[model samples]
Target chain A: AQSVSQHNHHVILSEAASLELGCNYSYGGTVNLFWYVQYPGQHLQLLLKYFSGDPLVKGIKGFEAEFIKSKFSFNLRKPSVQWSDTAEYFCAVANSGYSTLTFGKGTMLLVSP
Target chain B: DVKVTQSSRYLVKRTGEKVFLECVQDMDHENMFWYRQDPGLGLRLIYFSYDVKMKEKGDIPEGYSVSREKKERFSLILESASTNQTSMYLCASSLFVRTGRFGQPQHFGDGTRLSIL
Candidate 1:
């Protein structure tokens, strides 16, 4: 069984502020990581994913995430965030040879204009 | 773009009633998933179907069952709805890659917010 942990429960930021959300997973085997964002009154959309190879992956809307294997972490980062970036971010992890993904408690990010 | 459409955006039902949530995908994806989203819990997988007439129990499947009679339709059924089952239910679909772990970037539906009173 695998579990995902999102360090922050809620985050508030001003427009153009830098954003970083910590995510860690507990799994010993090969794992796939993903970041999904859910905007208000919208469906969950894939922000980015890490399958293998390069650790840093870029996603839509200038969002990026780094997969640190040693730390079992995949953190989402953005140099400058806008009001539109306000959404609930979820970190999900799926182990190799499995068909299910485990999601964290999610972090609610509110960006003030 | 792939489109996963859930039948109802908001549903209200009473306890002990049978509930069914419908989902349809236009991409003809081989994999379909049903999940429940709560306030703190991001999303918990309740069921998954890889192919027609093939279903698998996910992390939390004690009270939920899934049906996949066709390639594009997946239904989540609650035998006896309970108050705890009141949450936002999401449907997702993705192509099945033989070489991949599960699937890439699953396309999600707008979700159905069910309230069991």
Candidate 2:
């Protein structure tokens, strides 16, 4: 079955530190990928999405994710973390004809001030 | 701005009781979905509707049913609530098209944290 996997369950980083969250999926065909973030007491918000075209996609709040088809990976990264960046991040994949997404376990990113 | 609204922010109910969770989207989106967000489990889709009166079972739709009588509203129903069903429920909506913007990015509600005792 098609599924998404987020390798990091929780990560802690000091302010200004570079951050990377790993995500991988098991699917044989073309797919759409997405990254969503949920801050404390807030709803899930889209960070970035990759449907087609270039493998590198940039999203809101200076976050970006690169889709590597060979590795079945779509990893999220940020050059420098801020205290406000602390939140839970999720990686999701969608089947070609499906509107619903299959999400990974999610990574809780804690950016210490 | 597009908005998805869930009826309740938090709810508590007794086991075996019938429960209704309502979601409304103002964007006139073609697709509406219900998902449960649990710690360590991410978001698992429960049900989704593509059009009025049409519904499809998602990955984990065993304990839930959905209603989409109107274009803007989607309701998730639990025939009999169970403790194992306690989790945060989220509502989302997206538009459907073909080509360039084939699919609208999904917009999510704040979510309803349901606790069954």
* TM-scores of the candidates in the order shown: 0.97, 0.96
**In Å, what is the interface RMSD of model 2?**
2.6
Chain B alone, TM-score of each model?
0.97, 0.95
Compared to the true structure, candidate 2 yields what TM-score? 0.96
- In model 2, the runs with Cα more than 4 Å from the true position are B98-104
Candidate 1 per-residue lDDT, tens place, A1-113, comes to: 78899999999999999999999998866888899999999999999999999999999999999999999999999999999999999999877777677889999999999
Candidate 1 achieves a global lDDT of 0.92
Per-residue lDDT over B19-71 for candidate 2, one digit per residue giving the tens place of the 0 to 100 score: 99999999989899999999998898899888999999988999899899999
Q: Write the per-residue lDDT of candidate 2 for residues A1-113, one digit (tens) a residue.
A: 68899999999999999999999999857788999999999999999999999999999999999999999999999999999999999998877766667889899999999
Give candidate 1 misplaced runs (Cα > 4 Å): none
